[model samples]
Target: MQKGSFIGIDFGTTNTSVVRVFNDEHGYKTVNLGEGGDYPFSSIVAIPRQNGGSLKFGRDIKNHREELSSDYEIFTSMKSFLGTNKEFKVGDHRYSATEITTLFLKYIKDYISRTHPDVDLSKAGLSFPVDFSPEARRELRTAAENAGIKVNSFLSESTAAYFANRKAGQAFSKVMVLDWGGGTFDISILELKKNSITETAVFGERVGGDDIDFALAKRVHAEIIKKSEVYNPVAFEDMNLASKDYLISWCEKAKIEISNTEDDYESAIYNYGMYGTKSITVSVNLFNGVVEPIIKSRIRKAVDAALGRANLKPASIDAIVIVGGSSNLASYEEAITNIFKDSQVILPDKPQWSTAEGAALMQIIGGNFKLNNSLGLYLSDGSIFPILKEGEHGVGSVIETLSFSLTEDTQDAHFNFANEDGVMFERATIPTKGYLNEIIRLSARIDDDQIARIQLYNNSMGDLQHSKPTNVEVNKLTFYYDISGLK
Candidate 1:
């Protein structure tokens, strides 16, 4: 109920957290939102099988999981499937990822309203993974709006974590953020000046703690069958949904235990109908063997790629900030430390809540979003005609009537788009027939939604006499740029 308060929502894949921030005499203060001040609860939604039953979310689902039985259908990691054609069904009703997300967000809104009735939910910032497609980003915004929450801004997860951990008045020319969460791994290289933070490069993949949990569950299942006296025990893949879910939950707990303990950890599933009681001790070596491939192939590769794109060496990075639940793994920490031995590595006390807190902080201190890649046209002579240079402009800006001419008569004009490194990422073609020296006007803009739009017009003929250029084969291109910084 604080005046000028804004909320920051980190709607994560496995869990969700909300933080409320408002200015005070000192500066800004943040309050975590949840029942009993829990802040982050599970990002789970459950639908009851019985008719006319209410949908359950987060803590409600976790606390009553045992009673769910066959009467409820549970869904998690819905964030990963947003903007896709994937759907979840409850009885005869089918729900899209956006719909499920809306329901979950509405739950959070209602929960906060109970304690802070005067809090304005409209002014809020949301965090998302850097690798989320344009469609996914749009869908997330739609879901928030549908839930009656106005999204003031969208910040990438790694950037939010950086804002959360960064010290006031501290400056670092080059900092790397390694965010390994439940459903996504994101790496971002940022440049921090006095009051501005700019992202130089970012890389991400759809692999994280959830993946490790599933893999570990399978391994434990195999070990249990081998040690059991019953011949031809049920295969892990053939197990019932409830049994599988239970095993996965156990494995997730064991993964955390293994990370915190040096000794071999015992994982168990007890009194689960046909599964009975089974326990397996997992050695650190075994756990490492199972997760090393993911670490090397996805996590390590993403870090190297981000650094390469930013044209920075490990030693040049002043600090490395590690955040997210999966980052707690000892092996991941060790891998990061080894890779950047010269750089200072920092692990915040509450990595899980960092993104939400940082997002809230962003709402208090405004930031600007800039392009991390250059948008240009590839000329006929194999030369690049730059339209909008990287980091040259911030959002809500436009460039109109930038003049260009065809070098030769052609049926179509090809426009190639590349990142800052000159590696092509997209190509667009506009159909037109014009002689050499004919004028072509190009317009480019970055909207408030962080979408870059480019348009090409055929101004070859003397069409400037009219109110606008002559319309021939007009071509338009659009792409999302996921980078934000302080103003």
Candidate 2:
């Protein structure tokens, strides 16, 4: 095992998957760790303290939620809160969300280290939401660094899925990635052109499986409230005795059963209660005439919103890749197919493994790079930076900025300009869908006046910028800042 064999970690909201490149008799294969597989790690985390000290981490934490007091910080859905500058309350000591996330990551790292005692983990690739900002990425990097892993770079979820598909022998020219994760949803259209992949536009919303689960829980509670008042005719307090976990677990199981059953099941047990020595089942129903529409509506709106953002009439996309655990539902996939008419939405083999596998491939390929063609500049070598002015929306006009870097003793670095097609976003007239129309076009000018500026800064003197390595590229050096919304 080399010191820096890039490991891909898809630390998701509902489930976490770790993938590493492994060499076997069948050649190199991406190994995905699941339960009971030599390396057993669950995303579930429990922070119960002994003698008032918080439990560091484990699957045991979520299992003991009802038994733990306020002192025990049993947390799930931490993935939803990433990039949000919020502090978590665990007993009297409060830690930022980023800090809590790092703790969980540390737990995973320790688990891996113990499993692979001989391997050195210097470089790791982390997966993030498509909508994450540069600041959010910096925070993620900081968290991973604190957890004792040196994060090499950040990979967008769709980007990771894209690579995963490629590794599985699926090829495409222009693709659309529809990812509905546990806590976040994102849709992106990418172009695979001229030996490079470019993400054209990305639309992300904080709505996914977790939101659906919450909706189900709320609906079940309401139904229980109504049923208890009419059927039991006792104090309302007595009817609330069932544990929340039992209800949610039953509901989850009921959901799975409904998705799998060929015959229409009429009723479902919402919760199971223990009475002295025996357990009793509290049932609910998906076939119930009243609540089915509520569940359907949520799923419908989310899907419509995702497709709308891609600005693609379903027929235009070459292929729509379904990702995230929620996409497994037969109903959801059917809905997507119905919406697209003739186009096909292919679910990659091992849908859950797609993102992590893709991320590992991204680690080998590096990121998408495009020349800043908007800036009409004729440059031989150096660094490029965009200057900006604050506008009404946020950052507006593009102003030229200065950048400096070090050149090697014998190598010459060539400065290149790369730009992506600009996106024009316009809100749709319809209220149900979040947003509408967007157009993508590559606009570059060869004129010397509009070219983006590139100037190299060197800490080590002697004016050696011209003599540096010519093999060096500006994917690392050029900085892109969108100034459209600003004044």
| lDDT of the candidates, in the order given | 0.75, 0.52
State the weakest 10-residue window (summed lDDT) of model 1: 471-480
- How much does candidate 1 score in TM-score? 0.87
Write model 2 residue lDDT over 13-63, tens digit each, in one string: 776767776433344566665434633244555554435565545455444
Weakest 10 consecutive residues, lDDT, candidate 2? Answer: 426-435
Model 2, clash count? 35
Runs in model 2 deviating more than 4 A are: 1-4, 22-27, 38-42, 49-58, 62-65, 68-71, 118-120, 167-171, 226-250, 256-311, 371-487
> What TM-scores do the predictions have?
0.87, 0.66
